[model samples]
Target: MKQWLQAFIAAIQFLTRIPVPVNVPFTNEVLKRSTLFYPWAGCIVGVLIWGAGLGLQLVLPAGPAAVLTLALAVALTGGLHMDGLMDTADGVLSHRSRERMLEIMKDSRVGAMGVIACILVLLLKWSLIASLMTAGAWQLWLVVPFIWSRAAMVWGMTNEPYARAESGLGSYFQGLHRGHLLGAVFSALMLSLATVYIMVSVPLEMAGWSASFAALAAYAIHPWWLLLGAPVLGMGAVWGCSRYLSKKLGGLTGDTYGAMNELTETILLLLLVLMTGWRG
Candidate 1:
């Protein structure tokens, strides 16, 4: 139990800028075990973002609130995943040989391709989030994408081989077993279900539905069933994208894993917006 708590803290520390109060040992084994709690770390991030969005909405319009929320999310993670996304774009869009691409990703300098990709991705995220906010559909359920995207990262780490032979951050995560994947998936699913229930209940209550009716509605419609599809869709997006990257690069790198998470989060948000008709 103590070891598991330490692993969870390690995961939180590694994944986000959030400080863990406990002093945890840093070891290869601890890092490997920390993968088990990556989804949980994402949950923490999602909750913080959701809280920030809610607070911002009190004083700001939907458009500005959404943009601020997005900024806060990026700031919270210190743009770690975004950095990965840029690195990936720099490499993959160069259209060079795989070796050259990898070298470019490893390079500290950000190329023009990386800058362009970052702008496009952030723009899309801002637009989508604003749409959701305008529709009042941005709720506690917003955490779903964050949870599943990190779970997808774990999936990549578990299923795909690390691209580089040299020591790096990605190397520490290689060789994870199926058990790690199962742990992440389980955590993600449980969180998803809880958020779905909250999402459904909120609207039904606003409509003056009774407690029993709200429970039934939560199981039946409004958001539960639709929102439940998010993880499934997110996992699918990650799997297909990761597979393509693997084929192109010969294996997955830390940068590709970050790219997978960012892409999955964006895709999931798009799906939710479309399903809810938020734009209309």
Candidate 2:
């Protein structure tokens, strides 16, 4: 339990700017256990986005608000996942053998496929955020998708072997135990519940007590029932990405994990926005 808590703290420290009162013990064991903490890391990221978007709404116009929201998502993580998505896309579509595909992913130059993938993903994210803001379902849809996306990364890392001997972070997490896997899922579930309580229930209660708050509050924009979709999509993404990577490269890479997280989040966000039936 201590080790698991340490792993959680380490993940929070590494993944977000949030202060979590954690001093990570950087041992090999701690690093291995860190995979379990990934979903919590994602929760921190989601909270950052939620807070930032709410604050931005108070100050910025709709045009600039959408841009800021997407920009914060990219900037918060240093665009690490997006880079992975681009590189992996290039590698997969390079029309090469497994070894050559891995080689392409390692290459520094962005290939044609990478450029196209990046552009499309960025545009899709921009559109999704705009739709979410227009519908006011931003918090409801944003929370679990972001949380579960990183959980998907944990699933991939724990289940798949490392594709390359010295490729990336996946090599570090490939041997994570079942305990680690369960820890990640539990953490994600807890975070999802917390988000629902705060984003849905608290608001509803506050609006009930105060007319001014109710007037300013858009009618609970996102459906609470949509919360269940995140974990399902997250698990599916991990299974599909790992299966494809194993077929193509005989294993998985850190880049593939990051790529999977980014792709899943984008897909989840789009689905959530569409489900809200908000055309923006």
TM-score of 1: 0.90
Q: Lowest summed-lDDT stretch of 10 residues in model 2?
A: 215-224
Query: 9-119 in candidate 2: lDDT tens per residue?
Result: 777775655677757786668877786778778877877887788788888865578889888888878788888888899999987999999999988788999989999
TM-score of each: 0.90, 0.86
For residue 173, give model 2's deviation from the true position in Å: 1.7
Supply the TM-score for candidate 2: 0.86
lDDT of every model, 2 decimals:
0.84, 0.76
Model 1: per-residue Cα lDDT at residue 140:
77
Tell me the tens digit of each residue's lDDT in model 1 across 21-131: 888887878888888888889889999998998889899998899889999889878898999999999999999999999999999899999999999999999998887
- Which residues of candidate 2, in runs, are more than 4 Å off? 1-5, 17-25, 209-234, 278-280
Go through the candidates in order and give the C-alpha RMSD of each one to the true structure. 3.1, 3.3
Q: After superposing candidate 1, which stretches have Cα over 4 Å from the reference? A: 201-232, 278-280
